[model samples]
Target chain A: MTIRQLSVFLENKTGYLNEMLAQLAKYNINIIALTVADTSEYGIVRMIVSDPEKALDILREGQFTVRMHDILSLEMDAAPGSLSKILNLFTEADICIEYVYAFSFGSKSIVVFRTNNRDKAIEIINENKLKSIREADLK
Target chain B: MPREKMRALQTERLKELVNRVYNNVSFYRQRMDEAGVKPSDIKTLEDISKLPFTHKQDLRDNYPFGLFAVPMKDIVRVHGSSGTTGKPTTVGYTKNDIDNWSEVVARSFTMAGISSDDIMQVSYGYGLFTGGLGAHYGAEKVGCSVIPISGGNTRRQLQLMADFGSTALACTPSYALHLADAMAEHGYSLSDMKLKAGVFGAEPWTENMRKELERKWGIKAFDIYGLSEIMGPGVSHDCEYHCGLHVHEDHFFPEIVDPETKEPLPDGQEGELVFTTLTKEGIPLLRYNTRDLSTLYREKCECGRTLVRMKKITGRSDDMLIIRGVNLFPSQIEHVLLELGETSAHYMLYVDRKNNLDTLELKVELDESKLTDTIRDLQNLSRKIEHALNSAIGLSVKVTLVEPKTIARSEGKAKRVIDNRNK
Candidate 1:
């Protein structure tokens, strides 16, 4: 399973995010799953995009400081305890999940998460036979 | 017979300098007394070391007329260096002094193979700064048809150079390069110009720059070195060989010495250049420190002049930079920047110390429309500049790419470096 993630370095200013989004719109790059890590000064707008490479190129060419990072995406049943089950397996395997975000597309639930121990998390996924999606898998 | 007569004349001038400095300037008198030496101690040229060394700061401390040996009424002209802060170091010249200054500068023209038949255009700035008037008077003294085109007006400078059949030009090396660029922009060929020789000075320039200017303008580039403190633009000049500048030691006694210790050094050893004005009647100096770092030689020159010669000034003691335990000069940075080709002349160095490490950040202005603000391109240029600076200065510099027209230009002397690293 593949997940698209955008890492944009934002300077502290009003309407900077809006300006960045407008630039993306001009370049015809679409944002799908989106989240923001914010500080008092600026916010890092992270998004799963329809075209990650083109979005990155457009953002960079427009002079927006950006980086691309790999994220783990898991497709689960759109049930109440699906994310909870994944978290319990990570806890039992002694893998610390830094943060997690989830979005639903029809009946399928997609949860993206980061762990301190990526290898341990991958092992737990294999042992528990959990469905894990990579960035290439989405493409 | 000629050598004996020259020695007698030099001795007579040296005795006059000793008496003037001892009687007139109290600083020199005190300094000479402290050294257990009197005016009577100087018998020959070798006795020059017995005198006290004069420094540029001494001129600054005294300000306008404290260093003059003669009365102010006898002083006919006053010129000065363009100092940034406070008052500049003012130099006074009597009528005889002006005549001597003109003679030395005229000799510089003759060394460059410029003759009375040549129409010389003097482009150095005039006024308090001595370059313009100095060169103009010198060209006139040499019987050359002089065009006192005192700097700027690049269009008019070019027009006069062409129209007046200007066979020679005198300006700073940078201005000469600027004129060449302007000529190219106006679709004029330098090859078609009657210009044969160029006497470039008032700033230290490298031999590479000489070659570049010569190749561009098809003229012989002569290095004329001088300062207002030392009577301007004819202290020393390059001959046809262009090996080293020959100092008129008969008029001005040249010495190379340790800047800090004040002890004289052997020939070929790079040290601070010091001069004692022998024949200067108004403001004769007793071993005035020039601060310019260069070596000296008393060997017979191929140009048939027995005067002492000095190497091209590599750098100034005041401008020596210690960056990350490495010493650097602005000329080194200029060489690198000129080699890069795409960067503008505007550059500002931001030096800061953090975590006990000295950091040098060179903010280079990009040429207009040369490179966009794309992250990749900026990073690439930064890397390229960093590598070049590291190789040139022997220290890694954080290259900050700035837009054009950010850095300020100096009207008189260009401030090439901003040094913030202090002990």
Candidate 2:
């Protein structure tokens, strides 16, 4: 299972985020979940949008430098220790998570991650019988 | 000499200078020949306008000593400055050339009221740069007991200023302020030192710097203008009037001309400053376009020197910054930032190459009062800055917003450009 996440390069400027959002908004795109990674000079905004391909097109057409990255997205029980328990498998496999973001909906929580070794992470995910989502499941 | 007589003297000197260069320096000879002119043609001062303009590139092309108008044995001393790339610009001075240099600088010191009784400490860096020894010989000629205190070692400078009872200072204006700072930390004030007047040169300084140095040291601050190519420091010096630099036009003739058209501009019309060395024996230059933008005033000063005075140089045509193939001056960017408000004049241009393409990153500070709790506001401010810079420079640049006082402060010539591409 894979999730197409969009990464956009952004200058650390005021209203830049709003401008990015506004550009997506014009095309009626919905941002499912997003997080920004930043240094002093510039920042990169990563997003899991309803339509990743459409969002990429809209942002790129607006002159925003965008990159499409396939990340591992999983569904977990909305319970305490759920993330830690799932993460222990990766710890055992010695796979490192580059970055991660999560959102909870009712009793189900969705976690998206970029890792150093996707194959190892995926193998661990399959061995644990972890329920992952493909691009169509988001719709 | 009177102004009219000075013009005649300059005309005669110009003719002699042209002939010397045509006969000795092959570079100038070729340029002169290409212009379809000979040494005999430069009969008057006006004939200088007909000569081909010399650029910094020409100097770089010639490299070490291709422009020397005298034999190598006649050259007693050599001075050079590093170019941006490749070879450095070298200047030669014969024994007579050194003497004349000393004479002009001595005249400059006397004009600044420094006498043999005063302990003149020269603090400009010695070595290849003309700042140090230029003031040294001049002050020594003026009978001032020169301290020969070359640049750096701040504490020692202050200590020597106190220990030696140095009565006059010669260095860049910024170093003077730095010394003022050093003195404050030593539990001493301006009155403790015997510094009466400071002859600041070797770099461009503003009138505000003069006022600040004057106020801090309780001494008069005078501007000295000279370039290594034109016989080092003492080409001109501002008298007590502080109006403009009174150029030693007799030895090295001065001209202001349109940089684009290369046509000589009338006095008071600001343009590129050009020079022709009349008395330089080792490396006589013919119409060396300094590219320093300034205006010339022919009126005699109240101090009674008949030498023409050039207005303080504002900027350089060659200091033209080209980032991402777009041409702009740093002052233009500064103007845009100041106009936007919520920022200090402080900013650093960090130019680098990303993906083999040139990228400019402007690191600027946000005004202290404008610091906001919302990240959105800061982002918006940066966007506004990026937009304005793009509009002004006609090229998009990455704007990095830094906190107040984030950018390092400079005491001397502010280090504005940090080119990271080379490394």
Candidate 3:
């Protein structure tokens, strides 16, 4: 299961996002999951696509100013204490997490996170026996 | 003196320069050795063909004191580029070199019909760049009262021009236009000002631009040409006739050569203009390539200066864009933009390679009052701009309508193009 993610550098304008989406439509690349991380000068439009390679090539070819990143995916129970329990495990292991976002794919609750020490976090995840999904598994 | 006597004198100076550089600077000696030419071999001015040509990159590669023929203690002043992107090209001057530069600038001012009683307002920026200080020293040498305005503060510029009764102005042509716009906004009539003439340079401008400035400000606009590498903005100046800019070839030798072939071109044939500073002491250059595209004229001027004259620079070799085997220049776009009355001069050109196709997108700012929020108006403007740019540049451009004041305004050199073709 491959999760295609887009990291776009977007300068602020009235219809900049609309233009980007229109270009994507022209390439027939579908966005599965999308979020915008923004500052004053520009915004990064991150998206998981149905076809990662095709989307990346299309965006790069069009000079739309985009990047691709591999993010770890963890499925949590859709219960009250699920997120807290998973985060507490990382804190116990002294893994520094930078940012995290959550989204739903069908009935499953998936959490994507970035960490300061990726290798160490991976070791911690293996030690605690937490179920970690690779980008391909997310597909 | 006869032309034959002048040629002999130049040859003698050339031999002296070659011998001095060969004996003093190791770089020149090594380049001479690599070229298999010796200083003793240079017997005539035409023997310059045997010597190697120096380039701007040579100065940059050597950096601070690599090319200086004199000791650091003997050097009096140092000027340089802003070094915004890379290491600045540093130029050193002895006291005598400073005197020579001032004298040449004074001659330029005199050629423009500025008198000793004239008051000059120098608006070119000072510091690292030589334009402001060069003009200031030149004006002083010309026995004129000089105001070193030193760029920006348009309101204060207008105030001083009126208060000090500035008779002549020296600055980049674009800033002169900007000042004209400022005066209009303040409801000040340009005719009421005491200004009589303007000396504009440090960038290439067109005849249409000169005519526009002359009509708007009621002043005779003169073109002055120079580079920091060759003693700043006093190398040459236009006379009242405006036929060509006269070069002070006694100190600086001018040549035009085919950029691709490196072969010398005849007079009136357009090519890259090259200069060799014959009199510079600190950092004398032999056959320094200026990269500016222009032609040379040896004809006598009505002003009585017998020095060689250079045609107004049409474009630069490096600035030429080879897109789809068609050469284009930003000035070509400028010609079209000037014709479009509804569009502001401020614009941004985006060039990118998509699907192996070169795409040109022009973002032009439209004056809001002149534009109606209608599709037909936008379409018409776009089509007109497209047609004009295509006709002028011989390349199709996609015109994008942007709001007023959308593009950035630069106080120094404007950033006109954003090239994304490389990725």
Name the best candidate (by DockQ): 2
Per-residue lDDT for B1-423 in model 2, tens only? 798888898888888888888888888888889999988887778888888877767877887888887889989999875223335578999999999999999999999999999998999888887888889999989888988879879888998898889999998776787788678787777677888999987666678878988998999999988888888889989999888999998898889989898888999999999998888898788878888899999898998888899998776766555443233457667878888875788899977756334578888876644533234555788899999877766667788766456578989877787767535
- Name the candidate, 1 or 3, with the larger TM-score value: 3
> What TM-score does chain B get in every candidate?
0.76, 0.77, 0.77
Per-residue lDDT value at B322 in model 1: 44
TM-score of chain B of 1: 0.76
Q: Which sections of candidate 1 miss by over 4 Å? A: A1-139, B1-5, B320-423
TM-score (2 decimals) of chain A in model 3: 0.86
Fnat of every candidate, listed in order: 0.00, 0.03, 0.00
Q: Give the per-residue Cα lDDT of candidate 3 at B246.
A: 88
**In candidate 1, which residue pairs clash?**
A1-A133, A1-A134, A2-A134, A2-A135, A3-A135, B54-B287
Q: Which ten residues in a row have the lowest lDDT in candidate 1 chain B?
A: B368-377
Q: TM-score, each model?
A: 0.60, 0.74, 0.65
Give the per-residue lDDT digits (tens) of candidate 3, residues A30-136.
76677776544445577777677887788767656566767666777889999789889788878877667778777778787776677777776677777665555
Index of the highest-TM-score prediction: 2
Q: What is the lDDT of candidate 1?
A: 0.79
Ranked by TM-score, top first: 2, 3, 1
Error of 3 at A79 (Å): 20
Report the lDDT tens digits of candidate 1 across residue range B94-213: 999999999999998999999999999999888887899999999999999999889778888888888888999998886787788789766677765899999998877789889988
The lowest-lDDT stretch of 10 consecutive residues in candidate 3 chain B is B368-377
